[model samples]
Target: MKICHVNLASGYHGGENQTLQLIKQQAALGYELTVVANPKSPFVAAVRALPCRVVLANHYFAAHAASVTADCDLVHVHEGRAIYWALIQKLRHGVPYIVTRRIDNPLKKKWLANIAYRKASAVVGLSRDIVAKIQHAYPQLSPYKIPSSPVTYPIDETEVNDIRSRFKHRFLVIHAANMLQHKGFDVTIAAAKALQEQNANVHFALLGDGKAREQLETLAAGLTNVTFCGKQSNMGSWFAAADLQVHPSYTEGLGSVILEGLNSGLPVIASRTGGIPDIIDDHVSGLLIEPGDSQGLATAIMTVQANPQLRETLCAGAQQKLTSFRIEHTAELYQKIYQEVKSSL
Candidate 1:
């Protein structure tokens, strides 16, 4: 089947990465694929080598007029702005489209937005939390649940060794995400400071860069335990060298990094918030703490650090949880949805 995937996100993030994974998997299955993206989106570069056409659409208007899906059997909308583009295609040309909602945030309660969602062949959410939000915002709609999957990147052992060398004899805790306000960087910093006061032999390597870096850095000033490593390209190496991964987001659609950490055989301690509980079973797979609780975060960190058997158990549980979230399984589920939607159309 031929498919046109539309994602007009301004920058590449977790959602874009998931789109890339789906496109790659479908391409392997011999499906002709086309991607409609903003001209500056890093998603364009990421799929350039793949067996698919990448069309540039500066805005939703361009996306609608650009004949992106003339030869495609179906459209997959990966971002919000692209919904209208797909809706237009369906109305004007009878092109069936599927909307994949990735965030737990509620949709706008506007008439046009509601119509756009209602017109889709199917609506997919990355987690039950996201599906519930969509249903709450649009009671007439029933969104299907299709989750994001764990990613495994190639690891250079030398790079891994280099990272471990920098923080010798310290129990390293890695927190990787854009330093956005909702991501709870402030909570991680507070926990790091608390750990420092206790003279704990633990360190935090904060990964990724965003608008909140300066503010977070200021908050972490004079704390020797926290190091902000901005946007490293070799994430697999960093995951390899870290003792634990912490995701303290106050709210998350689904923590893709947590999946990656689990795939890397790393134990995780994350907050009990949106979509996180779906991925982790507290005390079974990984530990969970209340969002923005620095004291709780610090105590959880030390709990894992003090108990080697618990770490082993968590890692073992993490591996078990990962089996259900493999990219291959996610891709096959998407293909089934595509077939069902297309047949109904």
Candidate 2:
């Protein structure tokens, strides 16, 4: 099978990483793969390192469609903006395309989004809830649910020990998201401060960086329980050492970091928004609190930290539920979608 992944985002983030993992997993299965990405983007660098063909185009929608789409049996659009390029590829060249909508945010310019999905071979949402949302917005289209890559690496013992020794709190929590408002940086900071005020033996490390760092830091002034550990390249080590994962995002398509935490055998307490509930089974795999509810978040963390048996139960549940989110598993499902798109040709 020949597949081309078209992404226009310049910077590599969660969605880009998920696309890279998809291409890598499919390439390993001996399928022909190609990527259309920005000439200077980090994604192109990673794609070039693989066996796939790299068509360096800022937007394959207008300038490079003929070069990248003429021969490919199907194009998989990896971003919202890339859908237009995929649409052009299909309408102008008859190249079939599939789309993966990775966010729970309401679709803007509804008519345009409708046409885009309507033209695609398949619409994939990273979470089932996202798929349901799409269905409600555009009932004519059938969207599938395919979560992002799960924890693919084993825990590095050395790195784990290093982190463990550094932040030796009775309970170590990891809030792994870019420091942005929607990611709930304020909520995490408040929860951490509250936990500290209550004398809870806990420490939190915010693992990713973003534009909101300075503001969040200012908000968290004088709080000793939270540490901002700038952008981390290797999250596996952090997860391996953390006792619990706290993700209080205001919105998310599917929280990939939450999956990593569960796979690492740590409990998670996340906001009840976006695709989080898809990964966390409210008190089963991990606890769930309403978005922006710092008090509830603080309570969940304290309760989990105080009960070792509950921690063990939640961790065990996480392991049992994590298999479905693995990269290999996700790729296998997309492989079927690719085949279906190809068969339609």
Candidate 3:
């Protein structure tokens, strides 16, 4: 089957990474695939290295619509802008398309989103929360909830060991998100400060770069225990070296990094928002704190650090949870969705 994946963003993030993985896995299964993105996009370069065709075009809806509709059998769009373009292609060339809704933001732009939803043949929501939002915002569309396949990034076990050896016995905590206000990095910093005030010898690692980097650095000033590692290509080492993964985001469709950390055998301490509750059972696999609660976060950290057995228990439970999100299992589900769409066509 000929499939076209469309994303308008120029940067690489969880959604782009997940799309890349799907394309790679599908290509291995002998499906014809093409990617539509900006010419200078990192996604374009990344997809180019794969065994699929890459079509870089300007943001003009007409240009992209014409190009994609003429050759692709199915268009799998990643976001709102891509959905709009796909809608145009469908109207002009009768091309069927699917959309993946990846965010759990409030649906304040309902009218605009509903228009695109009505045109899509199927809507793929990354989480149950996202699906509910679509249903509430545009009930006419009846979007299906297809959990985003768990993300898998290449990691070297030997490298993980090397990193862990250097940070020996240090209570290391990592927050692997782009420095952003919504990501709640400041809350994490506050929690770290609270721990430090109690004379705890803990280290916090920030593993991404974004607009809030400078601000976060300033907030982390005078804290020798905090290290902003910027963006690392091999983040698995940080995951392996860390005692806990902290994700205090205000909103998320699904925290893929949390899953990655769990897969690496580290327990998560995240806000109880979006599909986080779906991934983590509070006090089981990980601890859940309310969004923006620095005190709650500090208490959880102290509890986890003080009880070694609790940490081991959480790690074991997290490993067990990893079974449900295995990459191969999610790939099979997507394959089934493709077959279903193909047979209907």
Candidate 4:
């Protein structure tokens, strides 16, 4: 089937990454694909790499709606602004589009969101919790749940070992996300303090940078164990070098990094919020703690550090569950969705 995928996000985060994965794999499956993404975004490169067309629409209000409609049998939108453009495409040219909502944050302008969801051919959330939230606010709209793909980049073992050796004596824990309040930087800092009180020989490599970095860095002042690793391109290497991943986010749509961690066969200790529970089971695939609970986060870290057997068990479970979150599986589900939506039209 011919498809047009739209994403207006400027940065290539988890949601954008998911879009790239689906488009690339589906294109390989013989689906003619076209992507309309922000011109400034690095995501344009990925789309160009695919056996597809890449239309650079930097603004949400760009005038490429008619052209995008002319090229595809079905339209799929990935992010917020893209949803708005898709709505216009549907209204003006009668092109039906499906939306994938990736955030748990409540819709600010209810009327706008209601119009888009109602008009869309199908709406999908990345997890059960996200679907529930969508259903609650817009009861007329029955949302489906299709999750993000667990895709990790290749890592060189020699490079991974070299990075690991830099922190030889300390147990390294990695937290990767854009430094946002909802991401639970405060909770992680508190846990770090707790670790420090006990003089634990553990170090945190906090990856990704955002507006909250200055404030968080100020709060973590004097905590030498914490290192602000402002956005690294090689997350797979970091996963390989680290002991485990810690994600104590107060809110998350699906926590793609956690899935990436599991994909790398690195066990994770994450807060049980939003779609986290959908991917991770407590003491099963990985460890889960209550959101914003520093004590619980600290306790889990300590438990993992104390027991070598627990790490082995979590990694084993993660490997077993990995197939379910693979990009191939995600692409198959989306292919089914595309067929269903297209046939209805």
Name the candidate that leads on TM-score. Answer: 1
Q: Give per-residue CA lDDT, model 3, range 69-179, as digits (tens).
A: 576778888865778778777777888888888889867656756677777777777778988887887777777666655555567888878867756667888888888
Residue range 171-282, candidate 2, lDDT tens digits: 7888988777899989989988888879557988888898999999999899988888999887888888888899999998999888877877888999999899998898
Model 4 per-residue lDDT at 64: 57
Predictions in order: lDDT: 0.90, 0.86, 0.81, 0.87
Answer with 2 or 4, whichever has the higher lDDT: 4
The digit string of per-residue lDDT tens for model 4 on 120-172 reads: 88889998888998888778888888889787788988878887887788888
Displacement of the residue 303 alpha carbon in candidate 2, Å: 1.0
Rank by TM-score, descending? 1, 4, 2, 3
Worst 10 residues of 2 by lDDT: 59-68
List, in order, the clash count of every candidate structure: 0, 0, 0, 0
Worst 10 residues of 4 by lDDT: 60-69
TM-score of each: 0.97, 0.95, 0.91, 0.96
List runs of model 2 lying over 4 Å from the truth. 60-65, 110-112
lDDT string for model 1 (1-345, tens) is 999999999899989988898888889989999988988888898888899998888787775653667888899999998998888888888899999998888788788788899898889999889999998987888788888998777899999998999999999999999989999889999999899978569999999999999999999999999999999788899999999999999999999989999889899999999899988999888999999999999999999999999999999998888787888888888888889987886
After the best TM-score superposition of candidate 3, give how far the Cα of residue 295 lies from its true spot, in angstroms.
Answer: 1.6
RMSD of 3: 2.3
User: What stretches of model 3 exceed 4 Å from their correct place?
Assistant: 60-71, 108-112, 155-169, 343-345
TM-score of model 3 (CA atoms): 0.91
Candidate 1 residue runs with Cα over 4 Å from true position: 65-67
